[model samples]
Target: MEQQEVKTPEAVAMLDMLKAVPQQGKFMFGHHDDPVYGIGWDGDSARSDVKSVCGDYPAVMSFDLGRIEIYGDKNLDNVSTDRIRQEVVAQYERGGMVSFSWHADNPLTGKDSWDVSDSTVVKSILPGGANHDKFMGWLDKIADYLNSIQTADGTKVPVLFRPWHEHTGSWFWWGQNLCSTEDYKALWKMTYDRMQEKGATQLIYAYSPGTEPKDSTEYLERYPGDEIVDLIGVDAYQYDKDTFGQNLENALTIMTQVSKAHGKAMAVTETGYETIPDSVWWTGTLLPAIEKYPISYVLVWRNARERENHYYAPYPGQVSAADFVRFYEHPKTVFAEDMKQFEKKK
Candidate 1:
């Protein structure tokens, strides 16, 4: 596929690196909030559950901008934006990539992202809506945060920006049932245009829907457009062990086809067996499911310190730790250290 044009040089390089991963027969290992906190600690600089199990950090580290829309100092998960900025730059310095997801509050109800009481929320935030200006203000905060992630030399760090994720599910206010397809597309374009106008150019936009889409036709139901999306991904988590692999493989097949048609990179944007009850889940389950796909990366959810059995990746002494080491050592898996090669070439 030909290279896709982007708004900034850094984003172009980042997209190139992402596109090269599958061609090189490797996919990056990623973990949400990897270095920011882990299964037993928070606010510890340079600590990660993945690194604790293996010896390297994830190549792609995911962060959430849940409360940034409200101008909150800390996100919904209680992570401070200041700390997130520091860790993002630190990861970039270490030759790793970062991605952000927003769980912005519902504009009409002033409730959390999960609030689906009002189905008109999407319409309320578009141009000329009562909450249009308020939502624009929220976008300003997000744009500022995106632009603030820079190296000491003032070069902006390129990042994967995924918003309105999992819209196929009705759990969030922007879900399929909550908004019209045209409204959803409009919402995405509005946000994209606003970010560009605000100069948050160091971004590669990713469109990630939940696993409800069984085929390309279903998947593209709410797709914004090819011109605006750099990556196409799916967020599917393991619920039943018996059906997870087949379901994930099916989703990946659809995504691979769609991405090929669109000339875009693809990924397993969010996935994992929570708490990792199976000892060899990494190699036995997750790896086998994704190994055949031309995915750029697969990111497990975060390891919440405050919640019991809420972690995804293994920490030290966990049942899956040894198998995770084997996963790390596998030639198909790329970590932060492995990413240095791409950085040098870029």
Candidate 2:
């Protein structure tokens, strides 16, 4: 791997580990909300469920920093600020990794992340725009929170910070069709620069676009640059029960090629078949889609227990429980217990 400038020793070690993943013949399995929320579970219940099924927890744990911009209370998705920091530190201590996604609400439209009502949201957040200062304030709050995440030994908990993700889709205001390429690039650069100015150096930035690209050109059409991006990935979901598998394969292939050309790590940042109605979806569909690529990690979306048909991982009695165990036991998949390999590299 070529020498690259990064913020922390953890970040440097993480890049080295990711670059060496192909030779390792394993990809870390990540679960969103595994530590914060779960299906018919939370906290230890979720971890216990994973342990009962696979005899280990997920190697990477995820949390969302959505409401931090608006509320300033660290209450995004029902997770408190203090608990989120504690969870990240705890995972780090246990030889696991942490990643965070942001679904920041539109500061101008006052709408959710999906709102593309005003295409100017991205432009407005750039330097000298209407909402530029307000957006900077939001970044400051995020920086303060990130700076506070430290382990018992006071080492910064390195985070895979994924912001402005899935931007290839037309849903978010920063989407390709909604904002100009230059405007979107400016948005990403400004956010990164502001966060750096506010002392959030422990973040490893990831650029993830929505899935199903025709070729590498489409995947890198809106790329900010290789300098500001540490990882490249795709956020694809299995919507069509039968055809989504092929789309996932195509997307991963394109992302893998592009990431390698840029000398960056790639990942399946977000993916899942909700409800997991197919008994063998884990080993049958999800595993096959990612196994061919030298990606760093594959993270499924959260399993919202309160909502029916909103989960990705199999729980105690779910139909796919047996197949999920098979997926976990696969030689190419790495769970929590297996993460010691990376920590040892550090």
**Most accurate candidate by TM-score:** 1
Candidate 2 weakest lDDT stretch, 10 residues: 43-52
- TM-score for candidate 2: 0.95
Task: For residues 182-244, write the lDDT of model 2, one tens digit per residue.
Answer: 988888888888877766778898999987468999888888898899999889898886778
Q: What is the lDDT of residue 343 in candidate 2?
A: 69
lDDT of 1 by residue, 132-246 (tens): 9999999999998889889999988999999999998999999999999999999999999999888888999999998899899999999999989999998989999888998
Candidate 1 regions exceeding 4 Å error are 1-6, 344-346
**Using Cα atoms with residue i matched to residue i, what is each candidate's TM-score against the true structure?**
0.97, 0.95
TM-score of 1: 0.97
